[model samples]
Target: MHHLTGHRNIVELRGAYEDRHSVNLIMELCEGGELFDRIIARGHYSERAAALLCREMVSVVHSCHSMGVFHRDLKPENFLFLNNKEDSPLKATDFGLSVFFKHGEQFKDLVGSAYYVAPEVLKRHYGAEADIWSAGIILYILLSGVPPFWADHPWIREDGEAPDKPLDITVISRMKQFRAMNKLKKVALKIVAENLSEEEITGLKEMFRSLDTDNSGTITLEELRSGLPKLGTKISESEITQLMEAADVDGNGTIDYSEFVSATMHMNRLEKEDHILKAFEYFDKDHSGYITVDELEEALKKYDMGDDKTIKDIIAEVDTDHDGRINYQEFVAMMRNNSPEIVPNRRRMF
Candidate 1:
């Protein structure tokens, strides 16, 4: 299971005991009871804390994906708190729904807590991405104190219907029947609204490109060292080197794109997109998807945004047909091709 998970966020399975009658597994015990407990106790968490939690969860999911292990059961209750505090780092636990992939084989077993299941999983033809959907639910809960997809009065129907009947049945029905009681119905509904979006993908791609140097579509030791200047992530050089070595698979002194993507793939696109879009919207005063020169100038005044010429240059470069205006398609094309050589950095790293 450890070899299959490949993600550091999972609790390490040191050993297991099994007999004809019973079985036990020795696993890392996190002091924190569970993320669900913290959320219920506190009601809500700050945006920064929410962001951090999402970051950690996404990272774990990404690792599971690369190694072909899918944590089909991911929810606040399954998230083990490493320290007995709300701020403690989280470790995803409960792999009862976990599966190891075979070539061309996709998951069909309907397993996991219902509230956090992915929509695709409901149809029964799903893969590792389903885990991503569950992580998104946790993110919504941490940030908004509620899940995105649920119905009103989840516990009992005023109309004398079954206890399991809820308006948010579409997603919940796919959870292998893990629906919560009435009080927690709204929590699931909240998750549906916080689903990841395309804009979030764009922002993450930029982050990935900035960290991945040498353009081998991956981040190796040398690339990570080079990217430190950009991330401003403070840590010992030795530690960073260790992380790089741990991720390096070919012993070619570099980490490939797969390794880097796998490491960060679990990041919640919604959280990233929401913040980035606000900034973009503020700069685009005219309500247009693209910012104009005048609007850009005003935004620069407020943001102390880098050199004006850099923005103009970007707009022009993306206007491949030289039409003097950048559209969503052009902007996305440029964003996807993030290498400096492919998309020159006209401004300073900052």
Candidate 2:
């Protein structure tokens, strides 16, 4: 909290005193009370008001992410207003479950409250994106006056048993209504569901380590500007800043491995997809949008990939429709699904 004191949206840590037995932290006083209480007192809030509050929440979270901090426990009760005024800024408090993380690192500890806890956090191996999930929960609660998920909700079952109660239709209706009201909130919800596979994450970590020339966990601006050219690409300072801003999540001046990976992961995917398409085009000699058994044999022969039988077996597995040919969709799926093997051996056109 002390390190994060300067941020307007965070509760200021005034001072701290440590004694033999214990330590005491003197923090800012928010007379207006908890955010939940304030919301109840308002009885109802306009979409504009909710959006304003949500923006403030994102700003603070963004600041925390920029600094490599994660407030694992983010809930309405943790937010307090400075005063009773209409514009009393909401400040995030309670750092008990908060943690600082290096770039590309993953946390396995299940530390947050259930309602605001992200799904990946529960599974472990979560990063800064967990906070974004919590923020989305807060946004849902702000709009609906109830959490989107609840411990007692009938839809949830223990022991993997089917629930006796019918799933609530109202919950689905509310979700639809919420999505209709806030498009950005819909995007945030989608982000909560987005996750990189373990293999992709591992590959990204390796990529980050390679770019970190000094072996430092974080990438400096100098390294970013100079290193890309070594990979046969050049980026201007402004572009570098934009990349940093997009990936840095924590406002820290340097890019941690996580930031580096997150920022470039999409680019990496696109490049792989391009390569897959090119490979497909190469095999589709007749421009028929499909690779027949003959084309597959010919393409495999060019690379000395496998025996005739081996090539046929490979195509047989990918030919889901059993049309005796692999269409562009099937070909792309095969490449992506077997990327670990295919990508490493992919022939570079250049």
TM-score of each: 0.44, 0.45
lDDT of candidate 1 at residue 232, scale 0 to 100:
37
Q: Pick the candidate with the highest lDDT.
A: 2
For model 2, residues 1-350, the per-residue Cα lDDT tens digits are 87786888899999999999989999999988888665443423568998999999999999998888988999888999999888999899998988898878899887987578998988887998989999999888677555565343345645543223222222222222332322111222222213445544433454455457788899787766665555333446786555544444445678775445434332223234554565566667888887888877775554344466756676667777778887766665453444333444434442
| Model 2 TM-score (2 dp) | 0.45
Which regions of candidate 2 are displaced past 4 Å? 151-155, 158-350
Quote the RMSD, in angstroms, for model 2: 23.3
Position 230, candidate 1: lDDT = 43
Give the range where candidate 1 is weakest over 10 consecutive residues by summed lDDT. 180-189
Off by over 4 Å in 1: 4-7, 102-104, 152-350
**lDDT by residue (tens digit), candidate 1, 1-350:** 66844455778787889999888889887887887766654545778988898898898887787777777888887888888865677888888878887546777767777678887787888888788788888888787655664333435344533332222211111111112211111111122223434432232344445565445576666656655544333546776676565444334566554433323332232224343344445545677776576765564444233356755765566557566665433443443333233543232211
